[model samples]
Structures are given as C-alpha cells and as structure tokens.
Target: MRVYLPATFNSLTELNESGVIHARSGWAFAVTDALREFYTSGDEEELSDVAFDQAALASLRLLAVGDVEKFPHRRVVVSADVDDAHVTPVPDNGESVVRLEPAAVELDDVAAIHVDVPDAEEATAKAVTAIDAADLGDEDAELTVGDAQDNWLAFYDPSELPVLIELL
Candidate 1:
C-alpha cells in the first residue's frame, strides 16, 4: 500500500536525526474505494494527486493547532510504500482517508516527499488560519485553503532533502 502521511518541518529534522517518522496525524491517505467513488473519472495518478492533496490539507491542520513558533509554516507530506496489512481504509472520514501505524514506518521506507517551499510559508500560514473553517464546510474557507495548495509545493526524493535542507 502506498500511503501519504502528513508531517511538518520539525518532524523532518527528527527523521533526519532519529531515522524514524511518527506521523503527526495517525491517519495517512491513499486511493481508496471512497476516493474512487468521489472522483468517478480519473486515472490512478490523478486519484493519487487527490490523495496527496488530502495529506497536504492534513499537514495544514497540524500546523493550525501546533505551536506556531516551533514549526515552520510549510506543509509536508511523506509518500511511502508499506505492506497492505499495515493500512486500513477510513470509510467514516471523507474520500482518500486511511489509518496507518506510525511505528510501521521509517525514513528508509519513504519514496518521496511533497512539501511547500519557503515562498509558500506566507500563503500557507493564511491557509492554516482557515483550515478549521474549511473542514466545517465553509465554501470561502475551502477556496482559501485550496488556493494555497494549488501553488508552491516542491517534490523531492527522500535522498534530496538532506542536501537541500541546508540551502532550503
């Protein structure tokens, strides 16, 4: 199973040091049946983008409640392939939601990461402030968050971050 786990910049530093990842949200995401139903016409890759977008929103949720001084405003999503047995569909939640144990994953298990870059911080911070309202079905708030997501994320292989960290 391929899972997209929400994370923060601080967690990435921890992964760099301790070599383990504890997803801030116990839930991860995937192209589940719920997602397929919600998005009736899309390829696997397109559905995967929906899943990744879900994780990015989860990341924003984390930032909204976390100590703002401690975590940077950027959102992070860790993409990894894990055993199917380790993943469980979350039907009660919205499309693409799933549950996965943090202990079952490690840095070495990751395939790639999608994160908002430095320039995204300002827009991301604005999105963070509106995520709660967005989740509550506010159309305006959803658009605010969606706008932030549509821009500024950079993709990286797990190996690229260590080198980019210093410069980023």
Candidate 2:
C-alpha cells in the first residue's frame, strides 16, 4: 500500500527516520504545522517544496496498519492543478483528483493467502480479519493463522499486492 502526501511538508521525512511512530496528539500537531508552513511559505527557495513532496512519499512507505485510527479515510487521494498551455482548464473541475482506495482483502472471501513475518519470534503473527478491521460485511467469519509451520504464513486470497489484515 502507498500513500501520496502533498509536496509541502518538510518535517515528514524526519518522522520517517524516527521509527516506532506513536499515535499521539503532539505528533499529529507537528504534521499539521509542517504542512501549514509549506503551503503558506513565500520564499524563493524551491527546495522546501521538493522536501515536502519527498517527505510525504517517505511517510507513506513507513506507515503501519496500526496508524489507521488517526484518519477518517484510510485511502489516499492525489490532486494536481494543471495549468499547461496545451490543455484548457475546465470551468469547475480543472484539477485532476485521483482516489486510491486501500486494497481490501476479505479473509473469508479469499481462496488462499500467505503472511510472513520473519522478525516475529512467535509461531503465528497476530492479525485481525478484514470484516473486523473495517466492519466490512455482516458475515460472522473467523479465520486462523499460523497453523503448523515456520517462516511460512499462508491464507486464501487472490491479489498481487501483499495484504495487511488488521492486526489483532
């Protein structure tokens, strides 16, 4: 899963370097402040803009499933304002807005899937079912992980991207 941050937050990259990001109020405020500075800056240095964009991308790369509670929408939306001479801008909706929803893989709906966490010393990696994670469906299904193996975690899913079921 990938997230796109606006090319305007400088301190985001620093947050990425600091592992084990906590879901604290102070951290959220820091992010908001960083973004505000980028959008409202009136300086000549373009490096600030570049740094902002880079930081956004890096934050997405380092995001964990546990961070979902902070935001209402887990999906990432990318917006760009196009002002090229070749193309004419629309009256109301000139900018391009793309919504990239989080790939939702149902634990019970999948045929076969695999999960692997080498760092996890325990036998099974603790995770939550898709339904439980986001209240997806009405079906009361319970799936199991780490049956009897080492360095091997498998489930029944049909998607290319690695799935991250909500950790229980």
Candidate 3:
C-alpha cells in the first residue's frame, strides 16, 4: 500500500538523523472506498491528486502543533510504499485516512518527497496559522489557505534525499 505521509522540514531532518519516520500509529491518506465514492468520476490521476491534497491538509495540522520557527514554512509530504498488512483505514468525513502499524518507515522506503517552493513560503505560513479558522468556515481564512494550496510544490526523487536535506 502506498501512503502519503504529511511532514515538515523539521520532521524530515529528524528522519535524516534517525533514518526513520517513527510513530506508534502514523496517519496518512490513501485511495479508499470513501475517497472513490466521493470522487465518483475521478480517474487514477484525479484520485491521486485527492490523496495528495488530503496529505497537504494533514501537513498544516502538523505545523499547527509545533513552534512555527522550528522549520521552513513549507508543506512537505513523503510518499512511501508499505505492506498492506501494516495499514488499516480510519473513518473520516467521506475520505480515507489510514493508520500504519510498524510505523518506523526507513528512508529506503520513501519513493519521493514533495515540498512547497520558496514562492509559497509566505502564503503557506499564513495557511499554517489559519487552518483552524478555515475549517470553521472563516471565508478570509479559507481564501488564505486556498491561496497557499494554489502554489505548486516541487518533487524530489528519493535518490536526491541528501541534496534535499542540504537545501532544506
């Protein structure tokens, strides 16, 4: 099973030092029955985008839980393939959230990392702080967060991990 794990540059650094993304039960987004039903007409690409977007949202929540100064204000997501036996679906609002067991993902398991570009820094920072408000139907906050999401993030192949770490 392939899952998108939302993270931050700080978290990536931790992964670099420890050589693992550790968790007792890590949360990720995947294409599950609910996601398929929600995007009834979505093709493979569209469904994949949906999963990525969900991971991006999860990144914002992760950012909110920490001191903003700890990392660059950019959204980061690591895509990895895990064994199906290690993943279980969580019930969410018409979406798929997966809980991963044996959650210590080695760097070797990551296929790629997607990171917001420098251009997205400002808006992404705002979105990081506005997530809760946006969730509560705050139109202005929603716009701020939406603006951030509109920016495209760059993708790095797993082989470029060392260079990516230096850049971060």
lDDT of each candidate versus the true structure: 0.82, 0.25, 0.80
Best by lDDT: 1
Predicted candidate 2 versus true structure: per-residue lDDT over 96-140, tens digit per residue: 111212222122222322233344323222222232432344333
Q: Write the per-residue lDDT of candidate 3 for residues 1-168, one digit (tens) a residue.
A: 778888888767767888787532478877777788877697877887888888887787778777345565788888888888987778664376888887778888888889888888899889978989999999999999899888877999977877888976
- lDDT by residue (34-108, candidate 1, tens digit) is 889987798999999889988898888888887444446889888988888887888799788888864447888
| TM-score computed on alpha carbons, candidate 1 | 0.90
Which order, best to worst by TM-score? 3, 1, 2
Cα-based lDDT at residue 63, candidate 1: 89
Global local distance difference test of model 3: 0.80
Model 3: how far is 56 from its true place, Å? 0.8
Which TM-score value belongs to model 3?
A: 0.91
* Candidate 2: regions farther than 4 A off: 1-44, 72-168
Candidate 2's TM-score: 0.19
| Pairs that collide, model 1 | none
Kindly state the number of residue pairs that clash in model 3. 0
For each of the candidates, give the backbone clash count. Answer: 0, 9, 0
